[model samples]
Every structure is written in structure tokens, then in C-alpha cells.
Target: MRNFEVNGINCVNCANSIKNALSDEFGEIVVDLEKNPRVVSLNIDDKDLQKFTDELDDLGFKLIREI
Candidate 1:
């Protein structure tokens, strides 16, 4: 699994939105809104990270970094 800091995911709705959007393509996703910097943990490969970033970008969010 990889941990990513997400920007613009400010609430439960946002977290859910991301989870729903990503779940189909990237299985077993976890969104932790309570964490500092807001984290999204997933089992996606590095090559697919950019695709994930793009999907998040479309939803008005960003995968800021892997931590």
C-alpha cells in the first residue's frame, strides 16, 4: 500500500467522492480525512499514480504527494 497526501479533500463528502471515484479502478482504497494533510491509502502501482492524480484532479482534488 502507498499513502498519499490529498489536497482539497475537506469533508466527508469529498472523501466519499474520492473513494467512489477511485474504488472501481484502484481497489481497496482508504480515505482518512482526520489525518493531518488528509491521506489516501491505496494499492495502486506507480505507473497508475498519474492516472489516479488525473481522476482526482477532475474531481477538484489533488494527490499532493506520497508519504
Candidate 2:
């Protein structure tokens, strides 16, 4: 799994949208809007990271960094 700090996630609905968007492609997605840095965790192969980033970007959210 990878942890990514995200921005522009305003509410639970936004978080749920993101989770739904990526759920099919990447299993076990966790969107923690209540976290200090607002993190998203997912279990996906490294090769798919860019695609995941793109998907998030298209959803009007930015993935700040991976940890």
C-alpha cells in the first residue's frame, strides 16, 4: 500500500466520490479526510501510480506527495 497526501477534498461526499472512482481499478482504497494531512491509501502496483494520480487529478484533487 501507498499513502498519498491530498488536497481539495472538502467533505465526506468528496472523499466517497474519490473512493468510488478508484475502487474498481485499485482495490482497498482509504480516504482519510479527517487526518492532519488528508491522506489517501491504496493497495496498487507501482506501475499504476501515474494512472491513479491522473484519475485523482481529473476528480479536481491533487496528490501532493507519496509516503
Candidate 3:
């Protein structure tokens, strides 16, 4: 699994949107706006990381840190 901190998420709708967007591309994605340090976590192969990050970048969201 990977943990990515997302900034500029302002509302629940945005959270849900991100969750849905990521879900379409990855499986076992768990987006939590309610977390202390709001994060988007997912279980995906390493080969897909760059593509997913690119997709997130295209959405205008910064992928802060990957853990």
C-alpha cells in the first residue's frame, strides 16, 4: 500500500471525487479526508505509481509524500 498526502482538498465533494477518480484506476484505494493528516492510500503495483501520480497531478492536486 501507498500513502499520499493531498493538499488543496476543500470539501467532502472533492474528497469523494478524488476517491472515485482513483478507484477507477486502482483497486483497494482508501481516501480519508477525516484523517488527521488527510491522505489517499492505495494498494497498487509499483509500476502503476507514476501513472497514478500523473493522473493526480492532472487533477491539480499535489502529491505531497508517498509512504
Candidate 4:
């Protein structure tokens, strides 16, 4: 699984919104959000990383980190 950290995610609604947006592009993917660090962890393919980043950027969220 691949990992990514997204910024501008403030609440559960934001988490769900990201999940929904990712689903449209990636189908069934896993997203784990930790409020303390304000990070979003994703379990996805490496090739889809750019797509995911672009999609999030289009949706107004910025990716702060990736692994």
C-alpha cells in the first residue's frame, strides 16, 4: 500500500469528503485520518499517487507528504 499526507482536512466531514472524492477515482481505497497531526493516510497504488494528488488538488486540498 502507498501512503500520503493531505492538509486542510479539519473535521469528520472533511475526511468523508476526501474519501468520497478518492472513491470516484480509485474505487475501494482505505483512508486513515489522524486529527492530532492533521494527516490523511491512504492505502493505494503508487501509480495512482499522481492521480490522487491531482484529484485532491482539484478538490481544493493539498498533499503535504507522501510515502
Top model by lDDT, which number? Answer: 1
lDDT pick, better of 2 and 4:
2
Arranged by lDDT with the best first, the candidates are: 1, 2, 3, 4
How much lDDT does each candidate structure score?
A: 0.89, 0.89, 0.77, 0.71
Q: RMSD, each candidate, Å?
A: 0.8, 1.0, 1.7, 2.2
Model 4 C-alpha RMSD vs. true structure (Å) is 2.2
Global lDDT for candidate 1? 0.89
- Scored by Cα lDDT, where does model 2 land? 0.89
Question: What's the true lDDT of residue 2 in model 4?
Answer: 54
TM-score of candidate 1 versus the correct structure, residues matched by position: 0.92
lDDT of 3 at 21: 82
How far out, in Å, is residue 34 in model 4? Answer: 3.3
Residue 18 miss distance in model 1 (angstroms): 0.7
Question: Model 3 segments beyond 4 Å from truth?
Answer: none
Q: Candidate 4, clashing residue pairs? A: none
Worst 10 residues of 3 by lDDT: 28-37
For candidate 4, what is the TM-score?
0.71
Poorly placed runs, candidate 1 (over 4 Å):
none
| Candidate 2 lDDT by residue in tens digits, 1-67 | 7899999888899889998888998888898877856899988787999999999999999999987
